[model samples]
Target: MFGLWAPERPTEAAVRSEIWSLGARHQGRPLEGALAELEADEITSGRAALLRACVAKLRPAKVRR
Candidate 1:
């Protein structure tokens, strides 16, 4: 888990890696949160740190809708 920084920067590979590992732990598990209604159908496969950040906490998708 990460704390809020005064300023945010681009996500790093290490952070992405963390996201992937977290995702793996909860793979196929159902999550209930504010964004719970959104389908978290897949645990992203690449960008380890980014994935980890995402999995650690629900982050906004890199790609825009």
Candidate 2:
């Protein structure tokens, strides 16, 4: 397995902070489950929208090869 994890991978605390800042609908729910699903690119509901955005925003930008 490649240890290609980016140095700036989003952390749970970052995710929680983003959720609070965005007033995401799923704020009070367990974040681990939601984060798992998001990483899998599951079909998102309204509740997960803000979380999705936060994840995308927090990740380092991909460079075009």
Candidate 3:
């Protein structure tokens, strides 16, 4: 398989940052629900899932504060 065919997985820190930025854009809405709504607007399912995963992983950090 050629390296070119593979999609790169984002680093955890990068994903975390993306989640934070996205949260800021749509404050008060749950991240998972936001992503789901976005997916209905033509975002790829895979991309949505990846973002959801990032949000889920970072959710505990938000709750601890």
Candidate 4:
């Protein structure tokens, strides 16, 4: 949710909270687009300001064959 030099770093607690939240949201799931098949799927944006935010978009996992 920030650009370089724009975000005001998030607190450790916030990062931890986001981690847990994302974890819960992804429980039993493949983390949305963590694979090649979901490459074109809609994405969830990262949060936590600038501490533990994930990528806003997803890159498909490469098929290793």
lDDT of candidate model 3 versus the reference: 0.65
lDDT of 4 by residue, 1-65 (tens): 35764646556666555545555667723334133222434533333232223322222457799
CA lDDT of each candidate? Answer: 0.43, 0.57, 0.65, 0.42
Predicted candidate 3 versus true structure: per-residue lDDT over 1-65, tens digit per residue? 77576656767876777776667776754575456555676776556666766766756665464
Which is the better candidate, 2 or 3, if ranked by TM-score? 3
Q: Which candidate wins on lDDT? A: 3
- Name the runs in model 3 displaced over 4 angstroms: 28-30, 37-65
Clashing pairs in 1: 15-49, 16-48, 16-49, 16-50, 17-48, 17-49, 18-52, 19-51, 19-52, 20-52
Candidate 3: lDDT of 54? 70
Candidate 1 lDDT tens digits, 1-65: 25453334336666555444544555633222212323456533343334334545554458777
Q: How close is candidate 4 to the true structure, as a TM-score?
A: 0.38
lDDT of 4 at 40: 34
| TM-score winner | 3
Candidates in descending lDDT order: 3, 2, 1, 4
lDDT of 2 by residue, 9-52 (tens): 45667766765654454555435445655665556354466567
Q: List the RMSD of every prediction in angstroms.
A: 10.6, 12.9, 5.0, 8.3
Relative to the unseen true structure, what is the Cα RMSD of model 1? 10.6
